[model samples]
Target: MKALVLSGGAGTRLRPITHTSAKQLVPVANKPVLFYGLESIAAAGITEVGMIVGETAEEIQEAVGDGSQFGLKVTYIPQEKPLGLAHAVLIAREYLGDDDFVMYLGDNFIVGGIADLVEEFRTNRPDAQILLTQVPDPRAFGVAELDPSGQVVGLEEKPQQPKSDLALVGVYLFTPAIHDAVRSIEPSWRGELEITHAIQHLIDASAEVRSTVIKGYWKDTGNVTDMLEVNRTVLETMERRIDGEVDEASETIGRVVIEKGVRITNSRIVGPVVIAAGSEVSDSYVGPFTSVAENCRIADSELEFSIVLRDSSIRGVGRIEASLIGRHVEVTPAPVVPSAHRFVLGDHSKVQIRS
Candidate 1:
C-alpha cells in the first residue's frame, strides 16, 4: 500500500507563526511534526509516498528532500489551493492510481502510529476505513455515526449539531473504489469537496465502510495550544541523555536530553526537557516540559512549558510559560523609564493617590 500525506493547508489557527512557516514544519520536541508522520508511514512498511503540498511546497520539499531518510520514495503533488481533503485525493489521482493508500495529515500526531490500522485495512480490504476518536467538541471536526452493529452509517463535516462524539482522526484508509465516489460527489457548502461527504456517498451506495475508534493519544497540532500540548506529550517519553557540558553549578533533573555542544552553567533545568545542540543556558531556570531548540541562548531568564525555536535568545527576561517563540527572535528586558502617574481631575471627581 502507498501513502498520501497532506501538508497543504494554510494554518489560520496558528496565526503569526504559520504566516512565516509551514504549520506542518512546527517542531514538537525539536522534530518537525511532519517528520513524525513520515516516520510512522515508514514504520508501517509503506515505501512509496506522495506528499500534497501547497504554497509552502518549497519549504516542505527542502525539509523532506527525496524522503529516503524515512525509507520512502516521495513524489510531491502540488495543490494550488487547499480546497479540501477530497480535493487532495482528486488531484493526486495519477500518483495514487489503482493503489490502496493511507491518507495522513502532516500536522496530526497519533501516539501509537498507524501500523496496526494499516495492517487491519490490508486484511479486511474495506472500501474505506476511517479512524475515529472521542473528542470533547465534535462540532470542530468531521464526525461519524455508527449503527448498532458498529458499522459506519453516516458522516458529516463540522456539523452544527453533531450526532456523535466520535471525531474522525486525521488518518484514513481507502481502496481504489473511492475514485468513483469522489467523482460522483459535488462540493459542500464550504465550496470544497469534503472527505466526509465522499465517504457518505459510499455509504449511500451500499459500499463497505468501516470505522475504528482509537483509544490512544491523538491530536491535530493546528493551533498553538495543541502544539504545546503535543510537545509536552512527546517529551513525556524522552530518555535521559546528557551529551552536553553541564558545569558544577548546574543542576539537571529527570528525563532531560541535552544535545551535544550545549553548555549549562549555574542553572537549574527540570525535565522532561530537551535542550538541543549549540544552545547555552547560563544562570537560568529551564523548567519542566520545555524544548530549547538548536543554537538558542537562555541567560538570566526563566522559562517553562515553552518552545523556543532555533537561533532565538531569551536573556535577562522574566518568567515565560506556555509560549511558542519563532526562529531568530529575541526576548530581553525592556528599557526602564521614569515612573510617574499623570492625571487631570474633573470637577466633583473623588480620587485616591498613593504617595
Candidate 2:
C-alpha cells in the first residue's frame, strides 16, 4: 500500500506566519507537523509515499529529500492549486494506481498515530474508511450523518446546518473504487471538489463506506490556538534529559529536555518544556508547556505556554503566555515613557481602563 499526503493549501487562518512558511512545516515541539504524519505512515508499514505540494513545493522538497530519513521512498506530486481533498486524489491517480492507499493531511496531528486504523482497514478492506471524531463545532468541518445502526448515511462539507456532530478527521483509507467517485462528483459551492462529497457519492452508489469514531487526541493545527495546544500535548510526553550546560545558578524541574549546546544560567525552567540546541536562557523563567526552538535567546523574561520559533529572541519582555512566535523574530521590552490616558468619547459612550 502507498500513502498520499496533502501538504498544499494557503493557510489563511495562520496568516503572516503561513505567508512565510507552509502550514504543514510549522513546528510543534520543535518538529514540523508534516513529519509527525510521515512518521505515522512509516510506522503503519507503508514505505512508498506520494506527497502533494503546492506553492511551497520547494521548501517541502528540501526538507523531505527522498524521504529516506523516515524509511519511505517519497515521490513529490506538485498540485498547481489546492482545489480540494478530492481533487488531490484525482491528480494523484497515476501515482496511486490500483493499490489501496491512505490519504493523510500534513498539518493534522493524531496523538496515538494511525497504525491501528490502518490495520483495521487492511483487515476489512472497505471501499473507503474514514476517521471521525465528535467536535464541538461541526460547522467548521466536514460532518458525517449516521443511521440508527451507526452506519454512515450522509456527508457534508462545512454545511450551514450540519446533520451530525462527528467531524471527519484528516486521515482516510481508500481502495481503487474511489477513482470513479472522484470523477463522478461536481464541485461544491466553494468551487472545490470536497472529499466529503466524493465519499457521499460512494454512499449513494451503494459502495461500502465505513467510519470509526476515534476517541484519541487529534488536532488540525491550523491557527495559533490549535498550534499551541498541539505543542503542549507533544511536550507532555517528553523525557527529562539535560545534555546542555546548566549553571549552578539555574534550576530545571519536570520533563525538560535540554538539547546539546544550550546554556542556562540563573534561570528556572519548569517542565514539560523543551529547549533546543544552541539556545541560551539567562535570568529568565521558562514555565511549563513551553518550547524554545533552536538558536533562540530568552533573557530577563517569563515565558509560559508559548512556542518560540528558531532564531527568535525574547528579552526583558515581562511575561508571555499562549503565543506562537515566528522564526527570526525579536521580542523585547518597549521603551519606558510617561504614562497617560487620553480618550475622545461620544455621547453615552463608556470606557473601562486598567493599568
Candidate 3:
C-alpha cells in the first residue's frame, strides 16, 4: 500500500504563523507535525508517498527532499487549490493507481502511530476504513452515524446536528474501489468534495466501510491551543539528556534534552523541556512543556508551556505561557519610560495582556 498525505490546507485557524509558513510545517516539540505522520507511514511499511501540496509546495519539497530520510520515495503532487479531502484523492488517482493506500492529514498527531491500523486494513481489506474518536464538540469535524450492530450507517461533514460524538480522525485506509465513490459524489455546500461524502457513498452502495473508535490521543494541530497541547503531550514522554553546557548556577529538573552547543547560565529549567542546539538561556526560567528551537536566546524571561521557533529571541519579557512564537521573531520588554502599551502585531494575531 502507498500513502497520500495532505499538506495543502490554508490554515486560517493558525493565522499570522500559517500566513508565513505551511501549517503542516509548524513545529511541535521542535519537530514538524508533518514529520510525525511521515514517520508513522514509514513505520507501517509504506515506502511510496504522494505528498499533496499547495501554495507552500516548494517549502514542503525542500524539507522532505525525496523522502529518503524516512525510508520512503516521495512524489510531490501539486494541488492548485485545497478543494477538499476527496478532491485530493481524485487528483492523486494516477499516483495511487490500483493499490490500497492510506490518506493522512499532515497536521494531525496521533500517539502510538497507525501501524496496527494498517495491519488491520491489510487483513480485512475493507473498501474503506476510517478512524474515529469521541470529541467534546463534533460539529467541527466529520460525524459518523452507526447502526445498532456497530456498523457505519451514515456520515456528514461538519453537520449542524451531529448524529454522534465520534469525529473522523485524520488517518484513513482505502482500496481502489473508492475511485468510483469520489466520482459519484457532488460537492457539499462548502463548495468542496468532502471525503466524508465519498465514504458515505460507499455506505449507500453497500460496500463494506468500517470504522475503529480509537481511545488513543489524537489532535489536529490547526490552532495555537491544540498545537501547545500536542507539544506538551509529546514532551511528557521525552527522556532527560543534557548534552550542552550548563553552568554551576544553572539547575535542571525532570525530563530535559539540551542539545549540543547550548549554553545555560543562571537559569532554572524544569522537566519535559528541550533546548535545541546553539540556544542560550541565561537568567531565565524555562518551565515545563517548553520547546526552544535551535539558535534561540532566552534571557531574563519566564516561559512555560510554549513553543519558540528557530532563531527567535525572548529577552526581558516578564512571562509567556501557552503560546506559539514564530521563527526569527523577537520578544522584548517595552520601554519603561514610555508608560504606554505598544504592539506591532500581524494580521489575525491574538494577544492577551495582563492589565
lDDT value for model 3: 0.96
The candidate that achieves the highest TM-score relative to the unseen native structure: 1
Clashes of 3: 0
Model 2, residue 222: what's the lDDT? 93
Pairing residues by index, what is the TM-score of model 3?
0.95
Residue 349, candidate 1: Cα error in Å is 2.9
Q: What is the lDDT of candidate 1?
A: 0.96
Candidate 1 wrongly placed segments (more than 4 Å): none
In candidate 3, position 119 carries an lDDT of: 98
Please provide, for model 2 over 102-208, each residue's C-alpha lDDT reduced to its tens digit, 9 standing for 90 to 100: 99999999999999999999999999999999999999999999999999999989988999899999999999999999999998889899999999999999999
Candidate 3 on 218-286: residue-level lDDT in tens?
999999999999999999999999999999999999999999999999999998999999999999999
Full-model lDDT for every candidate: 0.96, 0.96, 0.96
* Candidate 2 pairs with clashing backbones: none
On TM-score, who's better, 1 or 3?
A: 1
lDDT of 2 at 72: 96
* Stretches > 4 Å off in candidate 3: 337-355
